[model samples]
Target: MDELRAQLIATARAMGSAGLNKGTAGNLSVRAAAGFLITPTGMDYASLECADIPWMSLEGEARGRRRPSSEWRFHRDIYAARPEVGAVLHAHSPFAVSLACLRREIPPFHYMIARFGGTTVRCGAYALFGTQALSDAALAALEGRSACLLANHGMLVAGRDLKQALDLGIELESLCEQYWRACQLGEPVLLSAAEMAEVLEHFRHYGQQSGQQSGGKTS
Candidate 1:
């Protein structure tokens, strides 16, 4: 558990340094049998430590010196609704948050976005933090997808583990940026449903087999 906590802290800082999040605007969590370790509320990513993180049960009870993030409900709901999800990442990234403010769904304009396993990314209805309503809407929006944008709030991404969840968050933000840029030049070209089906099939296959071992030759 100590090593897991340390890795999460380091990954959070890396996300911060890479501009995925600013100040205390993002939160991360990793699942455990009893509960999960989550970043403390209102603490800047640069200053996070293993001891500063709080452990919270799936039911939202806490056991630590620090309080969980104000959006603990979001994390709890996701874990509860998606038993397969082992990690959750919420980020207030610029493009994704901007799109959220507009309350618009991110359509699958590029094939890479197909990794999300849906034809479009839904935006959850606006709700205040830590509220059950927010959690409900978020869970509903996330049906059949690994991620969703919280209306007027931010983005939520989940994966089988911490590293994969963080990677999905970054990919979602990049897709949002591309969508916004394409919108500037009139309606963007969207992939047809048939095309998206093929892409999704490829995604499932790729996900099933861990591709390209790290530090290994590409070819």
Candidate 2:
């Protein structure tokens, strides 16, 4: 349990270092034995200790000195809804926020769009932060996907564990920036549905044969 907490903390700090988040603008959580361990609300990642992370049940009861992230409801809901997801990350990265503010869906301008489990990254319907309404919108946007943009907000991603969640958060931000830049050059050409389908199928076997969880986390 201590090791898991340490991993979660390290990933939370990495989120800031990787520029996927700033200050207390995002949250991360990993599935725990009873529920999940999440970064506390309003705490600086640099100052986080294992003990500072809170354990909260899917039912919403919490344990630890600190309170769970204000967005804990969605983390809980994601875990409840997606059995394969072991970690969840939410970030307010600039590019994602910009596109989200426009309520835009990132079309398949690049084959990497399939990396997110779809040909387009859907932007969830807008809702106030930290509310069930937001969680509902997020879940809807995330249908058949591992990542989605929260309208007028940022992005949310899930992985089999902390490492993948961190990687996806970074990768998703990069994709958002790339898409934004492409848009500035005029409407970018999009891949056909058939093309994206080919990429998706290829992605299923894109990596090693070693048994690993989704998003490329080996352990």
The top-ranked prediction according to lDDT is 2
CA-lDDT, candidates in order: 0.84, 0.91
- Estimate, for each residue in 147-185, the C-alpha lDDT of model 1 and write its tens digit: 899999999888888888888888899999999999999
Q: By summed lDDT, which 10 consecutive residues of candidate 2 come out lowest?
A: 210-219
By how many angstroms RMSD does model 1 differ from the true structure?
4.1
Q: Could you tell me the lDDT of residue 99 within candidate 2? A: 96
- Predicted model with the maximum TM-score: 2
RMSD per prediction, one decimal? 4.1, 2.5
**Residue 45 displacement in candidate 2 (angstroms):** 0.5
Taking the tens digit of each residue's C-alpha lDDT, what string does model 2 give over 122-164? Answer: 9999999999999999999999898999999999998988988
